[model samples]
Target chain A: MASSISTVPHRAGLGHRLWQSRIDYLFLVPGMVIFGLFILYPLFASQWFSLLNWSGFDANQAFVGFANYAELLQDKYFWDAFARSFIFTLSTVPAQMAVSLVFAIILNNKLLRMSALFRTLIFLPVVTPVAIIGIVMTIMLSPFNGPVNIGLLDAGLINRAIDFLGDPNLVLWTLAGIFVWKWVGVTMVYWLAALQTVPAELYEAAKLDGVKGWQVTFFIVLPMITPFAIVIALISAIGALNVFPLIQSMTQGGPYFASEVMEVYIFRNAFATLNGAVPRLGYASAAGVFFGLAIMVLTILQIFAVRYLRSREKPNGA
Target chain B: MALEAASSAASEYVIRQPLITPRVRRWIVSALLAAVCCIWIYPLVWMVSASFKTNAAIFASEGLIPSQPVFDNYLRAWNEANIGAYFFNTLFVTVGSVLLVTIATAMMGYVLGRRKFLGRGFIFGLLVFTMFVPQGYTIIPVFELLSMLGLGQSLWGVMLATTGGSFVIFVLLFAGYFSQMPDELEEAAKMDGVGFVRTFWYVMLPLSKPIIVTVIVMQTLYAWNDFLLPLVVTLANPAIRTLSVGVYAFKGENFVDWGGMTAASTITIVPVVVLFLFLQRYFIDGLAGAVKG
Candidate 1:
């Protein structure tokens, strides 16, 4: 679309046309400058830094070509962190999408009352900082003394307080649960917006044909919102891959690094001394580059996959 | 006779299905929704209630209400924990970043959406591509850049970093908005001999109030809640730390000060929630616009 727009021919001389469009360039100056200086520069620079051996502090840097990348490939902890990150993404994205879809569908009902209040309340968590949620949840879900355990124990649902953060097996899943709880509302909002786009006339027609609720939702509503579902899934997947502050504040990838995701792994290596290890900026950069490229590839693939599905479905539906 | 007939008709309309009536269905749905709302809101309510309770009471009691609420926690969190300083620092960065983003993105969106120019597609595509790059990937070089600029460990440095990244959403929102606007207004301004920049300034910009508000609200929530950039950039400086970082530090410092910690959490979160409640219509609409566009 933008290419076509830019391809429009002008009868005027090239210099004159360029002069006429100078204002457009003027408007783009600040955005382009900032993007170049901050976003673009850092992006490519990280790739270069990945190939060099440099402590983030020292000016005396060693140019070790591909050594950092090679180390990352052999590093067990890096691969473990990558696998954990992948697991986190897989676990949270689908669960968050499902829960958000359910909430959105419920709230979309015309018979539902006080929907705005429910939505506002649900979305409250999204506005709260993840770090704060981590801290509060850490205390709220603390074993032996936390309210969640206390409530469960008092109700006789459990005999003992569950070690939500301390137990290695439970910690990652627990973080995923908290993440879903916090972010489901944003996805709900997205689904709600998509739901509104499904014309009411279609529902009326379906009802007139004596189509039941679940069938109508399955055949009509879901298909109508499939594009939105794809976008939401993509965004949620990327977001889950970037999980950091919550883990940092809550567990710091503790209990033997069970909850450590890619971002926390990168942060710990690049900035902080962890477990008697000095900061490894180069190694962290390599990990970041690898993870980033993986995400980019995944995103591109998902985009194409969604487009193909949409095109295939177009024959039978609008 | 007419009243009796109307009453009888109303009774006829109230006839129910065999399994469940419409009224019963509505009641069931409402009850279920209420239950879900309660579950969703429980943690926030717990946070607020626990903020007023003693540390022992917070752990001992599972109730939403405190046995004997006090203001001491808030007082301590505000005065001793230096939450007030963090609040100001967060406010400064959020405001600065929002202002910069709103202005820059609005102008960029205007040009990209309205003007036919060279490399427009390339610029827009680049922005879109950056959206997929995980934020953490950029942190290393961004830190290095800030250090080179001598802005590291400062709130302004954090703001610069915050404003630097993928604001493509705002640009997309504004562009989608501006494109939909009829060209007649700009054409009229052109006929009146208004220059392109002036036309955007005097006419298009004034008409962009809704999108502007949307960008401001969304960006405010983003900058205010952001943790990673501030944490990284201001790692060496505790004095300029944002609320999120402050609360995280407080947890480490006073491990057992649950009341003070919750109080600090509530303090940081409440303002955003309140702001959201007031401007939710614009916020939701803006978000929908961004997604749909």
Candidate 2:
């Protein structure tokens, strides 16, 4: 991709400079080729597709510029799915951060024995495939014979079994809860990494000062890690958009499309034949581009946040 | 010395404390952690145990131990459900993609990290910028492009698409690792009349074992667990479905085959679990390094 840029050196012509550095450029070829083919090209292709009215089934495509985006504005389903994506991010990211933060604190405690065992156990779910998690969670939360419901009933928590994934009202929150459980380990790791940044001398000083443990955590530790929490939250929010497999495996954005987020909505329009809906390739691309832009903005903010955090960490800036 | 003195003094005080003494506190923390662990691992434990249970017994009780264990599910999943094929397919795609990524990123990292080159900053900045762009709906174009090249229905297509990302982090990882190498290493190689490629191949690459292992472990987990691209690429060809896509399809077809589903799920998950157990340190540090990088 950068091959187009012709850099003129003070003592050598562009061609001469290129020949001199041919090996370096040769080394970049394989990766750049793959990147251009799979990533860079498709980005532009998706945008171009968003301008056409083409069913994915055929070659007949009518150029309908921005009509899809206009339609997306009035489309209640599109808006609902878009809103749900944000809702999923909002619902899960904080909960994930909070729970993981507490666990990270517990695991970070020096006095805690067998913390590595506990850490490994908590992290076990992070590596499990999301599709498999969806399948297992479906069974475990099955209303009829699921262990979760059975345990609840056995403990007299409720009069009857609740269809966790079947109820449209309850499904999103249920998926959110499972999402947290599956990914909390990752955020916990991030927190642990961040926690490790705090100098041990600070803790020793706090202990020598007779400060209570909880006070030390709330005062010194929390404030010190606040900057890292921002970056962690951003990463988690970006990850929250990647629930396509989980939703696809467990619910397929069903129970009346209640669990449908933007990704699922785009996927359903682009590929799925469910609900007798035709594959609106162009519109799905438009939705994709739109969501992609939103995520890009979040990502940019995160980059800046990280830069700021780094600057703050190293007072003598690089 | 001061640090040790401070910690030892603190421990002495902790041991003398009343009510919630250090020992009692340790037990309380342990109990709490143990409870959480049981909850966390219950589903995985349940799935593994259920694989051995008969279909009737799976629904009869959600017990961790099967009253009547059976090996039929494994045989059926392996023979009937096509998991055995999908496993190999996943292995092939993962290995191929990892090899591609490792080579490409390592080369890129070495060049950009060790040399001053034209467009280096521009190219590096471009890669970083693209990382933030969510790859929404690009799968359609990728699928179409693969088919256009007449490779869409093949596992090779899946491998290409899987590897066809910015991979900015891995590149940065390699770059950062290589950047920290001593200048003398390169000077020594140059003095011996070794050319750039040979020097990298013989000296630089060998020294980057930790980074390479980190990249391989991370990419293996990604390629093994990746679902969406494999689903799209192999949509027209069930014969080439990877483990993740295959497991989902198998579950869809055999909705009530709980025993078979459990067995297939276990087969899909075991390799990853075992890999993580083995390379747990690399996995954790890799994540931290990526974020830090």
lDDT of each: 0.83, 0.84
Instruction: Report the C-alpha lDDT of model 1 over B1-293, residue by residue, as the tens digit.
Output: 35323422322232223467756775787789899888887888888999999988876774788878888999999999999999999999889988899999999999888878767889888887887777789999988888888888787789888887548778887888899888788878878999878898889888888788888887887788787888887788899989999999899899999999999999999888888888888788767766676
Interface RMSD of each: 6.8, 4.4
Best by DockQ: 2
For model 1, residues A26-93, the per-residue Cα lDDT tens digits are: 89998877788778887899999998888876675789999998889898888988999888889899
Q: Looking at candidate 2, what is the lDDT of residue A106?
A: 78
Question: What digit string (tens of lDDT, one per residue) describes model 2 on residues A1-318?
Answer: 122233444678778877878999999999898778887788889999999898875567999999999999899988899899989999999999999999988777655678878988898888898888989999999998998999999999998999999999999999999999999998998887787666667777787777777777799889988877876887787678788888989998989999999888888888885767778889999999888887777778767878987898899998
**Chain A TM-score of each model, in the order shown?**
0.92, 0.90
Best by TM-score: 1
Q: In terms of docking quality, how is candidate 1 classified?
A: acceptable
TM-score of each predicted structure versus truth: 0.93, 0.92
Off by over 4 Å in 2: A1-12, A275-277, A302-318, B1-19
What docking grade applies to model 2?
A: acceptable
DockQ values, each candidate: 0.41, 0.47
